[model samples]
Target: MNQRRQKKLSHHLFEAILTGDARSTKALLHRGASPERRNGDGTTPLYLASVQGEAEIARLLMEAGASPDIESSGPGSDGTPLCAAACWGHTETVRQLLAHGADPNLREDQGTGRTPLEWADGGPHPDTAEVLRAAGAQPSPHRAVGAM
Candidate 1:
């Protein structure tokens, strides 16, 4: 397929994942949309799914060959799918990513070098933090100014 068409499909897939519509997401993927393709804002389908706690979508993306650790583009693009999941307190998404080989120690590109653990720590998800720690995530020495 042409790059333009593929990108369009990817964008649609991104939206489907964001809205937790696994059916459309699956249809898009089956139609040649790349699970790893980044959206206009540099986020991937898996990242958006993770951020929204769409565990089933995340699993489908991973099973379709999406990298658990794919980084976003542009400035401050250090956010991995794992980071997005952790930041949003998506425990099941985090578990799925980790099971898919996501790096627990990944830090945000523009943040205070906070790992998934740090992000989870500041969020309302202590269980997420425990998952990160169990997966070998370590806290960054300097927390973000607003980090809890």
Candidate 2:
């Protein structure tokens, strides 16, 4: 496929994942869609799925060999799939990512100097802090959660 067509398909797949349309994601995957194709924000389908708390989509992507630990590249480097899931309080997605070897303590120094845990703490998800702590995330003084 041409790059433009692939990019369009990737964007469509991302929208499917975000909308929690598991069937659409699966259909796209079966059509040879890439799980790791990143968007303008450097977020892949897995990352968008995690951020939107789409567990089923995330699972399908992971089954297709999506890397949960794929760090943001180029302009955006502060979030991973694990970070997105944790920040959004997607417990099942986070668990799946961790089981697939997503780094809990993955920190990006994209001027924010914030770890995944710090970003999670800043989000409204209550259990994210606990999850981060359980995953060996160190406390950042800037984060309001104050070390679990």
Candidate 3:
């Protein structure tokens, strides 16, 4: 596909992910849209899906070769899919990412510097915190408050 078309598909895939539109996301991926394509701030489709707690969409992107540990490039984009899911209290999404080999100990952006477990603990999701703990995730030393 041409660069223009691919760019369009990339944007569409991002939108589909944001809206939790699994069908559109699948179609875009089928058409060769990269699951790892990023927005201006370097957010991938998988990351967005995790943030939105769209497990099915995340699964589709992962199946299409989305890297669970792919960190964004821009400033404040140092978060992985697992980090996003954990921060948002998305237990199922966190589970899915973890099953797909997401790094439970991965830290977020510089300011936060929090691991998935720390994010979960800081949030209102005990279930997600338990999941992270079960995955062997530890909190960053700097943000150790409320860590499980």
Candidate 4:
């Protein structure tokens, strides 16, 4: 497919994921919408799904070969899919990403920021923090949530 058409489909796929419409995401994937595509804001499809706590859509994206650790590329991007899910207390999404091989300790902010464990620990999700710990994530001395 052409790049333009692919971009359009990816946009729609992102919308579907954000809206929690698994049927639409699956249809778009069948229509060649790429799970690996980045949004105009430079966030990966899986990142959007993770931030929204859309575990089903996240699973679909992973099945379509979306990388669990693909960081957002746009200016002010939020880092990896793991970061988004952990910071937001999306427990199931975090679990899905980790099961799919997302690095438990990936960080943004040029590596000075919190790891996924820190994000989870600093947020309302102590449960998420435990999950990261079980996956071998080291604790951050900073606990910097940063209003994210």
Cα lDDT tens digits for candidate 1, 57-132: 9999999999987776534444777887888899999999999999998766644456788778877579999999
Model 1: residue 47 alpha-carbon error in angstroms: 1.3
- For all candidates in order, the CA lDDT equals 0.82, 0.76, 0.84, 0.86
| 22-47 per-residue lDDT for model 4 (tens digits) | 99999999999999888877878888
Lowest lDDT sum, 10 consecutive residues, model 1, at: 70-79
Steric overlap count per candidate: 0, 0, 0, 0
The positional error of residue 118 in candidate 3, measured at the CA in angstroms, is: 0.4
**Model 4 Cα RMSD, Å?**
2.4
lDDT of 2 by residue, 1-82 (tens): 8888788888889888868999999999888788888888776788778878888888899898898877656354346778
- Per-candidate alpha-carbon RMSD to the true structure: 2.7, 3.5, 2.6, 2.4
Model 2 misses residue 80 by how many Å?
1.3
Q: Candidate 4: misplaced stretches above 4 Å?
A: 75-77, 141-148
What global local distance difference test value does model 4 have? 0.86
Q: How displaced is residue 74 in candidate 2, in Å?
A: 8.5
Model 2 TM-score, 2 decimals: 0.77
Clashes by residue pair, model 4: none
Please tell me which model should have the higher TM-score, number 1 or number 2.
1
Q: Quote each prediction's TM-score.
A: 0.85, 0.77, 0.89, 0.89
